[model samples]
Target: MKENVQQILAHFHIKQFQHDLIHWFQTEQRDLPWRKDKDPYKIWVSEVMLQQTRVDTVIPYFYHFIEKFPTLDSLAEAEEEEVLKAWEGLGYYSRIRHLHEAVKEVKEKYGGCVPASKEQFSSLKGVGPYTTGAVLSIAYGIPEPAVDGNVMRVLSRIFYITDDIAKGSTRKKFENIVSHIISHDNPSDFNQALMELGALVCTPKNPSCFLCPVQRHCRAFAEGVETELPVKTKGKAPKRVSFRAIVLMNEKGNILIQKRPPRGLLANLWQFPNDEHAPTRNDESFVKEISERYHVVIRSMERIGSFEHVFSHVVWHIEAYKGNALELQMGDETNKWVTIDELKQYAFPVIYQKIWQAYE
Candidate 1:
């Protein structure tokens, strides 16, 4: 609970910063779809999509998502697979899963309303401190800190905080500072203005200090270290795993695909059957394993291509191969054969889409 919040408040011009930041935001803020209304559902969706994603990238996706599931009830009622299909290219599938789960709980528990209280709202699935703060402040006009990476960076510079942002403990320090200084009259614009400042003017590299509304108030800029204030420790490298994806086709010209396990990474999504092996392993065993496990025989093998898919914590090095299903006794319940056009119906991970691009 300890914070340099008092020191931060004592040093910064809160009143002037609030006036300049909010005035700049009201006039210069981008016409984002989420800002059109105070619907908690829409705000919740946009905030979820914005996490670890760029604003431009999220615009179209936001429009499409709201169109598809315009209401919390609609989203709650949709099938999980169909929801995944709408969110296919967004990467972080878990976000949608958690959002979906929480929305359903909201629909049933809160009578289809997103809770304004921090305790009730944060109790829902995947509703973290950042999300809770954002939805509460933006949707309900609560005076709470939505301290994400952007807010942290902005505050780090303006207050000259030298905490390592990568550390979890650093967030509380920033959050406490935000809680005390957040504008009570216009918490909505205040929070969004801070975020907008970070995204547009106070960029990570070569910040537009001259154009920044609160640049004169920035201690880091005054000290000539705007870019150096938010020190962050680098994360561990993504673990690499190799797989030989076997693409089999029947006489009817259907491709073989299987559903991933219902839990863990890429759960419940369809993908090509992989002959899991090390990168140094020979293709002889790979082909042999595919034939044995899938109950299919192949006369010839053609190396389609080599591809890679990077996730947050792992990198999949995939080597794709193709052949006619010479014989078929397909027995796995999760395995199935579908036409190329029909393949578009089931949700496939971006890596499989890359494999398709290379295959075609």
Candidate 2:
């Protein structure tokens, strides 16, 4: 079995494959903002934003982010809240937070320059082998492999590797394979070409095998199981969680909002004050709970309806209730009353934005 696997891997013509892929990429690669230059910081930002997001979705966000923070010094010096606001609607708030933190490290420790060596780059927050490989190879011309899901899928089909890709161990195997076949002369174009092939030609479903540059060398194509070659186990379903969200409105029409804790899910973003419990709680109970928790009195309560937001691993089932606050006995440090115009200044997740729109 080992010899057979070795023979299969050895059959691929590395030089020919690299030549065709690079040639095709030069003519066919999309004109992206990040690819305009080899600035390491721009590459880092683009790579981070591209994770779990489509290219079309990221293009506008990329442009906006760069406009706001054009240099490493600009991003590092910016406030966290401003950064979160800039990253609003992008989801996965943690990515922006980590990017901000890493940039700060670069400014303070590395003299406002993105590190060129693998060791320094990997030490930055949220950067892994894939990110490190991408920045190094693409920006610095280092001969390293960036084996993301796209690259894994492409190689798995071409070499007919059936290992379940969900496993961490399987990723290492794919990375090793990429290191072996990556073009030493033009590592940047080589890695991007493989990823582009996976995105455009070797898609997850209904792949356009007829248009593949290396179709003649694909083991899955020869064996008639291209789609089945890249096997991956299904992840567990997201768990459901319920919450009771309270929108406390004063006589002046200012609504109450609270900043989430500085860690965990949706950290430091603003949202309506909420408590986790069964969705069966009535308006009175919700008002009473708010009064007890924050020392505020509600004169009248009305059900505003419900909203659901799904995360990668959890689904939020939120039941919203709006009420007029009759009295404020004590002020909570984390809670604030803001007008509708001021609400726009703080970053709210899409779920909260939808709720606010409904309320308006």
Best by TM-score: 2
Positional deviation of residue 327's Cα in model 1 after best superposition, in angstroms: 6.4
* RMSD to the hidden true structure, all candidates: 1.9, 1.8
lDDT of all predictions: 0.88, 0.87
Extract clashing residue pairs from model 2: none
Question: Which residue window of length 10 is worst by lDDT in model 1?
Answer: 273-282
- In model 2, the runs with Cα more than 4 Å from the true position are 1-8, 277-280, 327-333
Error of 1 at 279 (Å): 6.4
Q: lDDT for model 1, on a 0 to 1 scale?
A: 0.88
lDDT of 1 by residue, 1-360 (tens): 334567567867788989999999999999999999999999999999999999998999999999999999999999998898988888777899999999999999999999999999999988899999999999999998999998999999998888899999899998888887899999999999999999999989899999999988898999999978688888999999888886778888888888888778988788886875333377888777888777777767789988888889999888898788855765365888889998888999988888877777
lDDT of 2 by residue, 1-360 (tens): 133434656868999999999998998999999999998999999999998899999999999999999999999999988999999999888899999999999999999999998999999999998999999999999999999999989988989888888888888888888888889999999999999999999999999999889898898999999979688999999999987887788888888888888888888888886776334357666666777766677887777888999999999988877778854753465778878788898999888888887777
lDDT of 2: 0.87
